[model samples]
Target chain A: MASGILLIPGPIVISENVQKALGTPSVSHTSPEFVDLFASTLQKTRQLFQAGESAQPLIVAGSGTLGWDMAASNLIEPGAKVLVLSTGFFSDSFAECLQTYGAHVDKLTAPLGGVVPLSDIRKTLGGQKYEMIVITHVDTSTAVLSDVKSISEVVKNVSPDTLITVDGVCSIGCEEFAFDAWGIDYALSASQKAIGCPPGLSISVLSSRAIEVALNRKSQSSFFASFKKWIPIMQNYEQSKAAYFATPAVQLVNALNVSIGEILEQGLEARIAKHHATSDWFKNKLRTEKGLKLVSSNQRVSAHGLTAVYVKKPAEAISALKKKGIIIAGGIHKDIKGEYIRVGHMGESACNDSLCHIQLCYEALSELEL
Target chain B: MASGILLIPGPIVISENVQKALGTPSVSHTSPEFVDLFASTLQKTRQLFQAGESAQPLIVAGSGTLGWDMAASNLIEPGAKVLVLSTGFFSDSFAECLQTYGAHVDKLTAPLGGVVPLSDIRKTLGGQKYEMIVITHVDTSTAVLSDVKSISEVVKNVSPDTLITVDGVCSIGCEEFAFDAWGIDYALSASQKAIGCPPGLSISVLSSRAIEVALNRKSQSSFFASFKKWIPIMQNYEQSKAAYFATPAVQLVNALNVSIGEILEQGLEARIAKHHATSDWFKNKLRTEKGLKLVSSNQRVSAHGLTAVYVKKPAEAISALKKKGIIIAGGIHKDIKGEYIRVGHMGESACNDSLCHIQLCYEALSELEL
Candidate 1:
């Protein structure tokens, strides 16, 4: 069972406490204790999002892609227009998912290393009415971060009726996101990423307006992804009543409860600041010492959880890091798939001092011939 | 952390080995070692299903209900005709899920404690062509076991083109089912049931014909549940290549691999027989020794994994058992919701004599003043 340090963008190195929670004996999904745990976990997720009283949180058994499916299936009816702000691979995938459920999607793509400009978004909004607008807060593929707050502001000013959804899969816990303040209608994330839990659950916070649209949808294209069926279930669980639409992943939900509790104990602001500082330090070290160029053109739009860096012989560099007991990822962006590598600096690896994962990555890269 | 013996139908008592696997260090989904594990696990799942080489096994991160959604979204196109053979609550729910995806569903429901007659199925098939026929192998609500093999045979004889889908969530590892021999097009189950793993993954085996239907569909009704999108990814993983459509539930998959390995070690036939023997012993003790009635009318129709016994005071009896360090489930079938209780005997609890789970249930029931 010997393993190297995990530096992938998600399925990050979980804390021992969280792992213990995952190992807890299986419990019935309808048990009173599990209902309380589930309810508390949902409430803590709201705290993580900094959502208001009108927002509802859902924890479903699936990966982050399920979160995208939830938004597409629940909020948008068939043939409804959706504006997808494509920052990278994930955003484009979101648009594709929307299309799968019969939505007429219009994607506004950004350049390879940037997000769409606010003026372009405004112009797009003015041209036609949209049912929803999706923005990826941090695209894991390219490590590009979008200005969600500014985009939310512009959308609210120009098209207030359009729902605002943020794909926070790679950003939620590590990055600063104010669900209430930014006026986001839905923020979807997974347990694996910066949440510091194992992969399994798709967590999302939905505003009351989003729930309203879901409830009033003319036709539902999916069953498992429908928010209307799940909202009451979630609400009932949060009220300490056992309700079932489906049997949840008991172990993963327990792990999430423990992990979110840890996040709150450390304070969300401090955790985000820690990620920001560690990311800056690691990116700077790579630049100054290894002469590696990041895929992100500027620091302003770079993700704080992971850095995608261009390097010669990306595969060789990754192998060398693996040899040094560190596991980093190769680039995933289609155009530069072989030209860069990615090093994640989130969760326990970013917040704790034991691993010094940043230094390990730098040392591993320096020893490599690339 | 002192817990009682879990006798509920699902999320049942997990083995120590599987729980230990759940606490394994998180690994990257694309890691070569994980890829090997994933491939081996998928192959082992085929062995569990007794499926042939042509059948494809998929392990997705979701509950059993997601399996229904996957079947509906992938196999049944919008406005397509489907025949739903309803045994109990879960079967009706499956019909609802199919209709949500725009399927024209015609449901033939069995009586409270009985299964749909094979003659009725044959008559229905003779009337019109159906795109698919869904059978819940063992309805969890009433513990009623449908004769899936006979049903499949009737479907094949009457309308060979119609796909035969079995909801094996409550029966897969405990019941005797031969996917290839029975001509089952799709068999779907969950991790937490008889598989002895925690809940999260939706496990299924699809015949080559089912795969073809999914690939050649004019349009995918759902994104995450799309077989066309996932087939390649699943195949690539089984080929030991790192492919990603969505981040997997790495730890749970690892746990499943371990649990399935244990099942193989015990031998599937032996495990099934053990469940059958223990179920017979428990049911006989409840009926002859305690004068309790079962919701399932006869032994031939009773599920091997769980028993639904009718009691005058179901809730009080369940609470009384709980107070004496036992956990059982109240009835869920609408006709006898408050009249029966369920006790499960499956997985390690059924196969091994160490826990004496069945004996414990009998002792607990004997202590109850029913």
Candidate 2:
């Protein structure tokens, strides 16, 4: 079967090494080798997140949305107030997820192409006490990047007790995020996206404060997403011991270990800089050379992993790109569903010189009637 | 890296074709090809379950335990009474999962290496009103297969309104289960068990009644595991349309499509029979030749996908098998936690004679000092 370039927001182009790792023969989840792999992966995740010794990492078999469930079910008790900083579709979904877990969610939504201002966040935190504040580091829908560092600072100043949770699905590997320095209580990501692996595992790092809140929850509302059941299992595995609460996605985790290894080998800071430079170059080409506009509207608010571009006849442009053996995404933000397209440049697509995904995408767009 | 044969209860030996599919280039989850693949996979899952038109199949990114969460969080409302027929560790875990969702649980537990009596179930149903009854078709820990057909019949006769939920994580593809004819409401399985795929996806078939229960629930208590959000997305995807809630695991789903296609090509009945034959052959060799006893005690109640043999020095036996490039599992049932070892014969390992996994396992066991 002929395969095309994947330029969508996630499940992006994976490195050959990572793909090979994914196809490695299935191993017993409790096998000593697998345990070692799991342990090393956890330790590397801490390094990637720049987390302190007080932080714990969890790798569960699920998509990125499971991360939201983990934070909601574990940290916030039923009826607790949560403040969601919404920039796009994913932020709204995160809010809905909190509500499903019986948390009273208040969303401070930004303009469609903008991030919530630090002033607004400070005012919101000053007015009421929130058990947690959720920030989508980069909302995939609009390719908007929130100011997590600044938001963390505001929350620390106004409400030191409010836990800060970040949806890092679209940004973790590509964007510059310091969990320890930023004082993020919980940051959740997935194996796909900038991680350069297939989608399956929900990866998260938790602060001691977050773990404490989870342990003191009045009652747990989930089973698979429950941190209580998984904490010991993760801790055991990272300690190179076999503990089974549930059978993990063995192959996916194997691929994750490989991909994360590649990321660390490339150096996290260097990887982030590469993503930023590639994204800036691609966005500049689209704006100046093709006379196109972006959903994020400005570089400061734009995500480094993906670029959402406004276009006329998005279906036609997407079809034209597909005919060129490339795949991009249409707008997902509800208010501007059909007016734009999203192209992701992360992981191997951004780092590898030979892929030339950016050039191909630009050529495809330039050739489009729109 | 030298890989050993996986004879554990799950994360079993997968086929080359399935592994190749796992490494297939990443594609947009919303792409037409992926949508068709997702739709066909769901349809094939229904066929695998022998589910009628009134049934809907769901594929979520998680392990088998996530299926338990789906059943509990979707079907049973908080404070509703649930009857769990427990045979081993997995069954007890399922009950714990249900209780985590606030279900009031009453467990009709079997003695170690036994199944709960149908008469006891009838008596229990006659005495109390249960919103749901959960049965582990084949509990992985003990290699005990519950008579799901008979249990479903008893439940139908005693209380027709009570939803019957079967934990088929270890049994679905290898055990003979007729979802529609047996009147099962919800049956949950995983990709890694008997399905000949790497672990990640929670595959479940839900009756229309169960879907209705999910739809009309007073409030959804889960964000990621919520059926209310996922049901429409599933329906849309199966209809060859792109609908987003959470990003589905694209590569794993692709692998699932291939594995399920292989199962369908082999014919579900033939596949189940192959597992049974292979299991019986392996068990006979252990019993007659090696003079080894099994945890299930009798063939009539034993699981076809795996055999749990009581052994002296399980750790040493496991180590011996591992040294011979074979991997088997140790006892997990609390009562016999250190008393036996589990050898799995399922999926491609059972159907493909070229693997020689059963023979290798037998040889490894025979070489071990009794």
Best by lDDT: 1
Off by over 4 Å in 2: none
What is the C-alpha lDDT profile of model 2 across A1-370, one tens digit per residue? 1359889888888888888888878898888898999999999889888897889999999999999999989999889999999999899988988998889999899998998889989999999999999999999999999989999999999999999999999998999999999999999999889988888899999999988888777788889998888888988998899999888888888888999999999999999999999999999988998888999968899999999999999989888899989988899899999999999999998988788988888888888766
**What CAPRI class is candidate 2?**
medium
Residues B1-370, candidate 2: write the lDDT tens digits. Answer: 2368888888888888998888777888888888999999999999999997789999999988888988889898889999999999999999999999989999999988889999999999999999999999999999999999999999999999999999999998999999999999999999998998889999998999999999999978777888888889999998899988888888889889999999999999999999999999998998999898988968989999999999899999999888888888898888778889888898877889988889878877888786
List TM-scores of chain B, every candidate.
0.99, 0.98
Model 1 misplacement above 4 A = none
Error of 2 at B369 (Å): 2.1
Candidate 1 backbone collisions, by pair? none
> Which candidate achieves the best DockQ against the true structure?
1
Per-candidate Cα lDDT values, in order, are: 0.91, 0.90
Complex DockQ per candidate: 0.77, 0.76
